[model samples]
Target: MTKTVQSRALSLAPGASRREMLNLTGAAALASAIKLAFPSGAMAQGTGPEVKGTRLGYIALTDSAPLIIAKEKGFYAKHGVPDMEIAKQASWGATRDNMALGAKANGIDGGHILRPKTHLYTTGKVMQNSQPLPMYTLLNLNEDGQAISVSNEYRDLNVQKDSSPLKQAFERKKAAGKELTAAMTFPGGTHDLWIRYWLAAGGIDPDTDIKVIVVPPPQMVANMKVGTMDCFCVGEPWNEQLVNQNIGYSALTTGELWFRHPEKILGMRADWVDANPKATQAILMAVMEAQMWCEKMENRQELSEIVGRRQWFNVPVADLNKRLQGDINYGNGREVKGTNLYMKFWGEGGATSYPWKSLDTWFVTENIRWGKFDPKIDIKALVDKTNRADLWREAAKTLGVPGAPTADSRGVETFFDGTKFDPAAPLDYLKALKIKRVA
Candidate 1:
């Protein structure tokens, strides 16, 4: 028992009844027994993390900052996962392949991954050999800050928040028998969904009117410079770098499409998480702590510099700085100072970190919209198997964090086109979409 409980047990009133004394003593005994059984709060001493560390992979996106910062600032070490490796992944495809291989085969246990990856991996939609790799969605890494950039070829068209102007322009190009392509990191990933949503909202069919292709986040700017793609949606600092290089202008930040939307997540192989629960907790706690650090305005500069180091992103601090601090230069003569569209790592009292099943439902629904998953698939069941919000709550409680989400869902989410996604009725949302591949 703690000192306070012990003191309460000792301080029995002079006229205290025998029953009162017995009750206090009994309560103290139970507390002591419980403490003894589960020492150090959750796990007994020496029964801490089952493993010292695990391999974690990350792309060079700014959203991967939490994982990078966790390793850099010793949060992983502070949480007893000192040997964690934050390896850089070549592309999202590489991430998927390595994830399927697992750490024992020189893959990652998990790090920063796209949120949809959890559903995709669990369902085996994107896995090699069509084999399902059960996974866990631990925590959301960050939100907002991803952008869609249009090539300078369309800069004269002045494509901004509304992409309707591109419809005619793309049609004209296609009429000339020229191939127009839109690039995203993965087929069923966030970038894919964002670009598709933007195009469809403006009356452009993503699959038919324009060719969609997969390009890694880091390669986005380079590919665009060589005229490999007409437009691309990706997380920074590539978009910011594209602006710097004068090759393209950002049509809009993804936040403009859906403010503070769910982006990347902390995902892991389920078998590894199940096998090492304590280690998993340590990793989560560490990343959570790092996320809090990254959210601080004062630390953003250091965050950019640290992640920009040659060993991490190999990017200059300039490409990452402006956006990380909420400064936007659309590169089409539009600039915003200190906007709220900045990437959020941890929102008011850690709300952003809490993994909402509603968001997962939308991802699953969107994937279904694009026919990545079958319409008859059980989204809720798949979400239940993959989402580990219960684990997030446990860590929050252990860390004495207040204001954790009380429910699983974040309620109905409305997008830029005024369409609403009611988590309770996902099919209704899907049916409302006019440009979806789903029948």
Candidate 2:
């Protein structure tokens, strides 16, 4: 897809006053001018229920932009949701559990979730829950430019650039009598799923021959240098960080799988929305606006600054911005431009804030494929339950950005094995799988 990211930047302060504006056409100065003239005010036409207070939880990642942008840009307050205590949780599991407990017990109302956690919590197919806090995906963060990187030793073994080099590296490592270990941030998360999928497609056994471990993003580089693992498949800055430090090199990027694959979503509990429909709708509208703002190409430098702050990803802006703009450095002193995978606002590259059922359905199908949940469940109904695109459309239209977002969140995925996955028919896909499923 040809993206028309407006070259805009956030002219606001470091913390909350900052608002990113979308600039189309790559006109840098025009994009900056647009950021200066963004239409920010109380949203009209939404008669949301009165929200006495608003609270949301998130873990630090670039994908958390919608939530961060919504807050910094005053979209929440404009939508009548101010005084939210944006808590920085310790881990992805902690974030989800905290939100689950808080939302359920009248603590926090909504949260950001790693896609798999959202799927697991919302469906309760395997981990049965009393309240199934059915989550609706509000919007997509970005099509991640995730990658799997390996040590310099593996690179010398002849892993190429055009494809999944990490997979090839794994094969080379096996021949060398070294067990390949790959690290992902969260289990059942996009990082984990992508890494495993990448490995499996390369003919490596993600479950057996290859070992998988969960490591925080920040620690990935350190661990690699110390030999905790050979390579890590993770989000930008981390992968880029590895490249800059000369400890490793890029094997393959997850975007290589599907460049525009849905990577992250705004997730909230079903009961939370049930009691606060107006509030939920308002929140969706605010985040949707933020998604658009992030689409601007010019606002990237500023975004890199905000995301790199200690309060967020806690890294240097140079490291963050270098990759944010697609200029990549594959450690061992290699640099390549056009590798930035950061998603810009105005729904960069057709990425919307609202959940696409097809995206959710894809995750659901993968959830069953990886044995994270049961394949016997009603996957179709569950996907529908987990995605609130219908609600998001109503709110987005009322808020006046545009008309209803499409409900194209369902489809079939054809893999290299000549396998077809109609997410609508996940059970059949599961039955046809060649790999063993966990009992």
Q: Report the lDDT tens digits of candidate 1 across residue range 243-331.
A: 99999999999999999899999999999999999999999999999999999999999999999999999999999999999999999
Candidate 1: give the clashing pairs: none
TM-score of every candidate relative to the true structure: 0.90, 0.79
> What lDDT would candidate 1 get against the real structure?
0.91
Instruction: List ranges where model 1 is wrong by over 4 Å.
Output: 1-45
> What's model 2's overall lDDT?
0.66
Tens digits of per-residue lDDT, candidate 2, 1-439, equal 1323322333432232323322333456444444445543233323545563467777666667678878888888887777555666666656666666764464456666666666777755423254465666666666655677887767665443333455566667689998778798887788887776666665566787678898877778899988878767777777777777878887756655655567766777677777788878778777777777777778877877787778767887776776667776665556677754444435522344556777777777777778777767676787666677777668767766544556574366664335576766656766775554543
lDDT of each: 0.91, 0.66
What is candidate 2's CA lDDT for residue 188? 79
Candidate 2 error regions (>4 Å): 1-48, 103-107, 125-133, 158-179, 332-334, 339-351, 410-421, 424-439
The superposed Cα distance between candidate 2 and the true structure at residue 191, in angstroms, equals 1.2
Which 10 consecutive residues of model 1 have the lowest summed lDDT?
A: 36-45
Model 1 residue 232 CA deviation in Å? 0.4
